[model samples]
Target chain A: MTFTGLVGRVFMLPLRLIINTCVRLRIHPNTLTFIGVLINIAAAWALALGKFVTAGLIMVVANIFDFIDGKVAVELGEVSQFGGFWDSVIDRFSDLSLFIGLIYLYSQLGRTDYVMITALAMMFAIMTSYTRARAESIIKKCKVGFMERPERIVLFMIGAFTNRMAAVMWVILVLSVFTVADRIILTYRELRDARQVAA
Target chain B: MKRAASLPARVLWNAFYWTYERATWQYDLMVIAILAFVWLTPPDWLNDPMASGCGPLGWVLAQLR
Candidate 1:
């Protein structure tokens, strides 16, 4: 295994321990998920204000909590349909609020182009998630894509920490759109094959 | 005498299987795509937004200066 993999495993150890503790305490996973979303919103707002390093730190910490919620849920045997649904819904809102905060900051800075691009990226990102949901609903497989939520969060952190907000927006725009397109194509192929067989 | 299923019936079964398999493929593909995107993208691309030097990065650095 790669050194980074080893480091990641080591870092996750403490988180796992915390999750176990939460489980033993019988804490509700949804509560932790909500807390995670709140932290993400705060971190995003900090980034929007150009507090890059601070925002990056907060984002990283928030993501750790995000990861822990699921483990906590599984350990506590408190996983429920509502728990997953709540997480998904809050995640969407958290993502939007974060970008909206950036929009506010960029508007204040008079960078309209960056604002537009960021908005586009945000739209595409949301669509990417929606496409998967819709495909699944239709009983078709459509999960082929290059960007996912974890990567998106990491990219945001990198942008905030390194102070390269434009680059982050660009990456999000390209990858998120690509992911959406990938899903559409996959869905089309599936439906087409099904049709051919029916004929 | 045992008779083979009709062509229409065979086609229907194949179609059903195809739909099932494709849906399963899509679900798995989404997971793979996400992983690849995150792991493959360059850090430089990730850093571009702040590179403009006129946005938040600039504002923060200006305060320090």
Candidate 2:
């Protein structure tokens, strides 16, 4: 493996340990995943209150739990269809809540310009994931895009920590929308090709 | 059942496979990093019209002011 992959694997060691512990204790991965979602929602709510640093810290903690859940599932051999589905569903909600909180914050601050951008960012963020999900429903492949969930989370963390609300919103809006469009076009071509081959 | 793959088909398949193998992980990570940086650092120039040189968007906002 490359150095980066090695690093990623190393970073995941603690998560694997947690997963093993959970498995030994008979704790379900889905339960941990649900708890992670709850933590994330609470973080988003905190962000809405302008507790940016607190929100950022909470998000980091929640995401660690999120990572652990996957490892736990693997260790416990409890990876289920519903587990993946619920995780994804909650993830979307978590993503949306962050931007929604920001929008509410900007609105309360009377920052109209920033408000629209924040709303747009939230919309685009949802659309980005939606495009990928929709495409997967039709195509067998997941199209890689410029912006993905990890990137979005990083952006939000940066914004929270730096107090760069408006800039973050603008970046998310532009990049997420672009990613959505790119995925849609990719899916359309793939599906069309598949149809042509069948015909 | 005996049809041969066309040149375009072969080329496209190879290209897709190459891209899938080579770029997916790194590209996704890079995009994520860019988003993180932008979000974390809202440029001061964005909020300051004078600093931003009254660019098109800034100029328009200035008109409203």
Candidate 3:
């Protein structure tokens, strides 16, 4: 198996039991997704208070909810287009809340520069998702990016655990910008090629 | 997957396998850049010096000392 697949499997191993329990409990997948967002919001609150370890731990639970929701949906045969869309929408909120916490913390510290940097990172990160979602509407699939949501979440956990969030922001900012641009170019190429094929 | 493989050999093989599986120069470059920033960048540059003296790893080192 590939490295990422191996890492993903390892990460999911512990979550598998939780997922099975949720499924057996017959919990609604959307309820799980909603609960995940609430937990993530609490994590953002911890982050804003500069409690890195607490925030990190809370995020781990939030992500477990995130993982379980999808698996439960699949296992319970509750999968639907709206479920996917709702999950994605909640993800955007979850993603932005973390950055907002950082921004608030930096703003309180009067570190306008870090606030700006954090904001830019947030913008680019969302744009990476936006570009793929927009591109996939045109192309069959547009996964031509390296800085996807999973990578961002992993980086967030690493930064929180190590207290190296500044460096993590830089990495996210650079890679996310590249990913957005990559998607744009790939979409353009695919659309142009499709046009040529039609002609 | 070979159980008889030496540790260093397994590490080297995994490195090769990872690069091959990544399938994009940009992915490799991004990984390298992150590693470089982690290794080479000054803590002061990021402006979070509170963690510099006793971040998680530093605290562990302090405990050891």
Candidate 4:
């Protein structure tokens, strides 16, 4: 296995325990997804207050639920289209809340430039994920992007912790916009090749 | 399935697969580390421009100036 795969699995160990407990308690995965949103709401509030450290820490814990819900759903054989849809919807909300908090913070500081940057970053981030999902509907898979969720979340948290907000937002915006373009091109090729073969 | 990809395409495809499936997460953690390092180390020249340059980052910092 790749080292990252090993690390990822190790990271998931504690989560597996929680998933077990969740199964024992008959807790629904959808409920867990909703709880994740609530935790992120707190993180957003922290961000708006410029409590970067608190928001960073809160985000770390909150996002764990993202992994746990999916694993629990799969382990319990409860995976469903609705469950996936709900997870994606909640994730977008979480993404938006972070940007909105930043926008509010910048507004208060009267940094109109940062406000626009945050808004642009947020829009491109959503588009990056959207392109992948829309492409997946028409192709086998659409993981052809550099700014996937893990990167975006990790970079944002690092930016928060280090107080390099501008650098992080710029990186996210550039990479996410590039990712959206990459998905479009990848999807086009896949569809085109499929058509050529069918003819 | 269509015929196998040509050798160059195969090599490129494998490289992309390795990046997406295997190396990207580890690389992401490394990037986080690197960004932190850049912020912490703060060579004077880099910091100066970063604090008041023309880009989005500089513009944000300029608000505080």
Report i-RMS for every model.
Answer: 9.3, 6.6, 6.2, 5.4
- Select the stronger candidate by TM-score from 1 and 2: 2
Q: Which candidate number would show the highest lDDT if scored against the true structure?
A: 3
Best DockQ among the predictions, by candidate number? 4
Residue B41 displacement (Å), model 4 = 8.4
Instruction: Report clash pairs, candidate 4.
Output: none
lDDT of 4 by residue, A82-114 (tens): 999999999999889888988888888887777
Give the lDDT of residue B16 in candidate 3: 34
Residue pairs in candidate 3 whose N, alpha carbon or C atoms collide under 3 angstroms: none
Considering TM-score, which of the candidate structures 1 and 4 is the better prediction for this target? 4
**DockQ score for candidate 3:** 0.13
What RMSD does each model have against the real structure?
Answer: 10.9, 7.7, 7.7, 6.6
Real contacts recovered, all predictions: 0.18, 0.15, 0.13, 0.10
The full ranking of all candidates by DockQ, starting with the best, is 4, 2, 3, 1
Could you say which candidate leads in TM-score?
3
Expressed as tens digits, the lDDT of each residue in A32-151 for candidate 1 is 888888988898789678788888898887787778877788777778898889888988887887798788888888878878998999999999899999988875556566577876
Give TM-scores of chain A for all candidates: 0.93, 0.89, 0.96, 0.91
lDDT scores in order:
0.73, 0.72, 0.80, 0.77
lDDT tens digits by residue: candidate 3, A5-42: 55667977888889888988999999999999999999
Cα lDDT tens digits, model 2, A161-185, are 8666566666778777767767776
The residue ranges of model 2 lying beyond 4 angstroms of the native Cα positions read: A1-10, B1-42, B48-65
